[model samples]
Target: MTPEPQAASTRADPAILSIADAIAHPVKAANFPQTILRFRNDRHAATIGLDALDDKRWCHHFGRFNPMPGNLPQPLALAYHGHQFRNYNPQIGDGRGFLFAQFRDDKGRLLDLGTKGSGQTPFSRDGDGRLTLKGAVREILATEMLETLGVHTSKTFSVIETGESLWRGDEPSPTRSAVLVRLSHSHIRFGTFQRIAFEDDAAKMHRVVRYALETLYDQQNGENDAAALLNLAVERMADLAASYMVAGFVHGVLNTDNMNITGESFDYGPWRFAPTWDPGFTAAYFDHGGLYAFARQPEAIHWNLGQLAVALRLISDAPPLIAALERFGPLYQQALVRRFCWRLGVVPQGMETDRALVGAAEALMMQGGLGIDAFFFAWMGDATPECPADQQGTEGEALWSAFGAVKAGYAPARVRTHAYWQGDAPQSMLIGEVEDIWAAIAERDDWGPLSAKVDAVRTMGEALRG
Candidate 1:
């Protein structure tokens, strides 16, 4: 039986007060004229105290589309420009989506309520501003999996299937349409700064930097200068990149526009989790050059950070900015070591020990061609680190010894009690599994498989957190 909805405990917050000047351009949502509620993420809604809303009330605010009290008066299609495939595109913006609202989470941190496929704005360059139902489903899975793995990512707030059909080149034509809302820490992208830099608007750039520092970073030490902000951003982005690497996630497109200033991963398009430890794995088919491959993700993010530094030059000199950019490498390396240790279910030792452990673990994965998720899940707590029969040779023994040395530092009683540790197979979200889940939905509209997958992923999350 479905559980009863809880009572509302929170209201909206006026967090994005700079929408009129620093960040966004006011716009109206497209008139899809039909609202069919399909999915609502009550778990995420409760983070901002909106989970108690009835279906009709939820649809009115997020679907039938009236702005909530203390939210933006109307949706604001944010302005920005980005480099697509390394080519600068000045005409890029929130073409189909808008910043619908802003609020504070339970932690009192500012959050954004953004949309995808809500409709067109001045940025919509002659295309139908709608999203296919399949797209919405894909995003939901992506965010859920990422969150489970402890990646800072956006939450899919609501998905309302608009009573319309969309024809697209990728999927089956005349596909069902839907509108999605995502809750994120911030919607201000690196591209937002790039746009002002491109226009040579120094005064506006300074204002944006100050606004971002105050609102997003919560830095009120009179250090809201461009150089200080860039320093903070570099550290955050490095940690974000390391999270992706350890999660075996390839974010397909790491474009400037897709990268938000808060370093949280959003806009899940063509994302994939590696089936095995293969650096060459590419998530997007069009990435024939392997620019954003599983291994090259750190490089892609570093390049994007360089572009951000270029934009910051509008407000600050080059020396401090360059110094800030120089910190990404060490920050990413340290973050990787820490994150890898956590995944191994061990308390991290010092940097040198952790780095050595990460290197040895990667070597083992590559040499044995082990499935990424399977290997991690199997060796989680070192309670019984067994080598596969096929991998019981000299090399495998050496790998096992190294792993054992690393695992000796942690106690296993915490995670051993979890039922997931007894499973024959680890919960994984490889391409085949995702496709199978989608096939179930597309063929018969059976949500059982998707629901089960979510539950399994959540179980894995609980085990890891313990």
Candidate 2:
């Protein structure tokens, strides 16, 4: 069952406490040298009734880690094990962050306030618990862009610049430091189950499964078994993979720890949007094998789900888990067609025609080297299709035919009425633009470009939403 509607004044529910304490360790937040507020997502805050907080109180709650009313008395550094790049690691958990609080949105959906770069915990091993200010900014941009593109992503609720200088090999030494708070559906990860399974605790695993089904997921048919939970997870992740593909996003690292049970995309690390439809496009520089590249995301997610299934075998039989895992392929294909049609601003035909349309779009992008943004911007809402003159042959012909078939089935669903649509190009958050935004802040302490970019991105989202 879903959590009861939280009282207006008692919003911080802390549902995770119902689980075993062994899964989470009580921890204190780091005392930062400074607490300068960088960003607060008022729009998302309003959903959970945090929009009314003044900057001072907001900083106290987020930056200083003060407990909210009726919330957890102390923060919890959640414990779990994960497979990093397919190498199983038993010694990993929340090293720098913790679950701050839990609450229900205005719509009664349970949500969590999880932190990043907040402090060190028992899990911190040979590393200082800190986050680069540049890293927080990138997460802000990534979540904003992904949410606008119709991906189910976590909202970057707060970013506070903590007065500290952090060293990292990937970035310039002694870069600025900060903390990030993410608003997400749940922080429970696939690795959470792996941790329990590692210890062979079947009863505790069952308790976690029940907590997930009752609190996190909605059941239409009243199923409440481990297999049912696995099925729902599989379906949600399949849709997520499809959304990432349609949005041209590369999550960079699709580790089992990063794959949350709720299927919402969070934990932005070296994320990037592909400039084009290159299957081999990789976001993280460390991804030499391109394991989580643009084209391999679906397979990676499927593999992670297999790990989840393996863990679920502690409480479920192999046959049911296998059946659940098999659903990912068809579900992903369906989601791809649905999201692709939605992004194109067109009414979709039946599955066969929709798949043909998607196939043609992929072929066109690969053959012509067209950027994803340019292709989507040119084709929104039944606008005139632009085909390059050089390759008006087979690929172009297939694309135009697909467009006609789709348009003939039903009229375009989106209109260019919003002022954002009046712009010549779509808003894109490519790596070059991200670096430029960071340079403004790093060099001159200028936040004008970042603010302007966020506003433009939001406006573009509004235009797309309409």
What are the per-residue Cα lDDT tens digits for candidate 2 across 101-171? 99988877899999999989999998798999999999999999999999999999999999999999999
Once fitted onto the true fold, the runs of candidate 1 whose alpha carbons sit more than 4 angstroms away are: 1-9, 221-224, 394-398, 409-414
Cα error of candidate 2 at position 275, Å:
0.2
TM-score of each: 0.95, 0.95
Tell me the whole-model lDDT of each prediction, alpha carbons only.
0.85, 0.90
In candidate 2, clashing pairs total 0
Candidate 2: list runs displaced more than 4 Å: 1-10, 219-224, 388-410
Winner by lDDT? 2
**lDDT, candidate 1, 342-421, per-residue tens:** 87777777888778778777877877657789888877765656777777776876787776676676564345678888
